[model samples]
Target: MSELVIKDLQVSVDTEDGPKEILKGVTLTIASGETHAIMGPNGSGKSTLAYSIAGHPKYTITGGSVTLDGEDVLSMSVDERARAGLFLAMQYPVEVPGVSVANFLRTAKTAIDGEAPKLRTWVKDVNGALDRLNLDSTFSQRSVNEGFSGGEKKRHEIAQLELLDPKVAILDETDSGLDIDALKVVSEGVNRFRGQEGKGVLLITHYTRILRYIEPDRVHVFVDGRVAESGGPELADELEANGYDRFLKAQV
Candidate 1:
């Protein structure tokens, strides 16, 4: 029964010139077991919306409110947001040279759960998640995302999504650099998460390919810092055929 509500969200970024607005009056809702895909052209502020919801410091919420099950998200810090069951899989997953993947995942899980999972169970869970993503057992011993390929990094993100089991997941282009096989594996991981009783997915992507596999219950079109239109899964097909030209034309 988790519900994530975003109402009239207005966000801006600080630049050398001045403050530049990114998201404008964006409103949407994602409830448990619903997958919402946000499709838009480049520079349309798709990632900005994801980062804003994830409480990234670079973007400031100039207006509106976001809530998770009636709790104010704006007041929560980045870590607070995670502990509050909000997860963001970045478009570019960063690396940590010294942090083993196992250690990092356990630390993050402990932070969110307020207690460390039993080592035996946690190790089994970690290995299982990694195996599902087509990663080897040795991967857990490697430093997080260090020297991994692009597809591997994205798969690692999905593995986190599965292991963390958050209430709401805001994925910023999880399909960006994956091959067909890797894409399917990652999609399976997301689908696995969606199978849970209390989970929602906010999938931000430019292409409809991933949508074919993940199957969004709703699709929203973003253009020029605002949500231009929203509809069912059919809207993603419309974007594939007609493209954003029509939406951009409407803006002009």
Candidate 2:
């Protein structure tokens, strides 16, 4: 089974003033068939951890290690990390101005698989993924995330998660900007991916609402760049009831 291990990880970002540390000795492990939820207040470095593991150049790893199934993930390039089966769904998905969604998905699939999928089967697969996400087949012709609503963008990301079939998915605040309906739709798509054998999910969110649909095997409370505490599904319920005030005080 695949496992994503993070050991004492430290990360920094280059701000105009100087380098600012975001993730401080953050460590956690996500194994196959497990879903982990990271819950924290804003500016707690939740997204930083996701981007760092996904090889974003904006964040620099100052210490510790990140490994995927015993391979050095910290050493891989951005695309290399994706091909290595690590996927990051950003809090804010960026726009690809001129590229059609169809072409982008196919190109990414080809890159990850090392060969293009046959046109006939690929077409059917793409359409099926889109339909499952409640997206119209015509959506394939539009520019990726360009002019699409926020819900559409998130749905598209899940569609990618399904077709690309990565070993692990790191989703940063995917529940944000989604209404009740959109949230359920997106959560369902993620649940479907988690159903696959040996798949792992690292869902970073500020709210516990989405957890109702996709229950986490573990819930981590992130505070001031570190995981303040971790527990089972009940920990999420605790966060929902008690909020992060206790964790914030402990950090102080």
Candidate 3:
């Protein structure tokens, strides 16, 4: 089975004050087919952990190792990480003014697969994925995320997730701006991806609402750049009933 392992990972970012550490010895492991929910308050280094693993140039790896099925993920470039079957659905998806959504997805697929998908089959698959997300065919012809409403952009991310079929998907605040209906749609897309064999998911969010739909195998409570606690799905309920206050107080 495939696995993503992070061992004592430490990351830092540049600021006017010089390099300040963000992720403090964060470590976690995700096995194939296991959905891990990372719940944390803002500024707790959740996004830093996500971007660090994805090879964002802004984050510096001060220490630690990240491996995917024994391959060193920290050493790979951003595009190289994608080709290695890692997908990150960003919280703020940037727009590419000239590239149509269809072309963007196709290009990503071709890169990951190492060959172009047959045109006829590719077209059907794209349309089908879009339809499943309730996106219109005209969506495929539009530039990537250009002028899209918040919900539309998030839906487009799921559409890419379905079509690309990555080994491990790291979603950063996917439910941030989604309504109930859009949340269900996005959750359904994630569930569909989880249904695939040996696929792992790292879902990050502040609210527990998405947990109602995508049942995580493990729930990790992140506090102060580290995983303060971890348990089964019930932990999310506990968090909802109480809040991060207890955890934060303990940390202090």
Model 3 misplaced stretches (Cα beyond 4 Å): none
> 86-109 in candidate 3: lDDT tens per residue?
999989999999999989999999
lDDT over C-alpha atoms for residue 227 of model 1:
90
> What is the per-residue lDDT of model 1 for residues 73-177, given as tens digits with 9 covering 90 to 100?
999999999999999999999999999999999999999899999999999999999999999999999999999999999999999998888999999999998
- Weakest ten-residue segment in model 3 by summed lDDT: 1-10
| CA RMSD per model (angstroms) | 0.7, 0.7, 0.6
Q: Report the C-alpha lDDT of model 2 over 171-234, residue by residue, as the tens digit.
A: 9999999999999999999999999898999999999999999999999999999999999999
Better candidate number, 1 or 2, judged by lDDT:
2
Q: What is the TM-score of each candidate against the true structure?
A: 0.99, 0.99, 0.99
Q: Scored by CA lDDT, what does every candidate get?
A: 0.94, 0.95, 0.95
> Candidate 3 — which pairs collide?
none
Give every collision pair in model 1: none
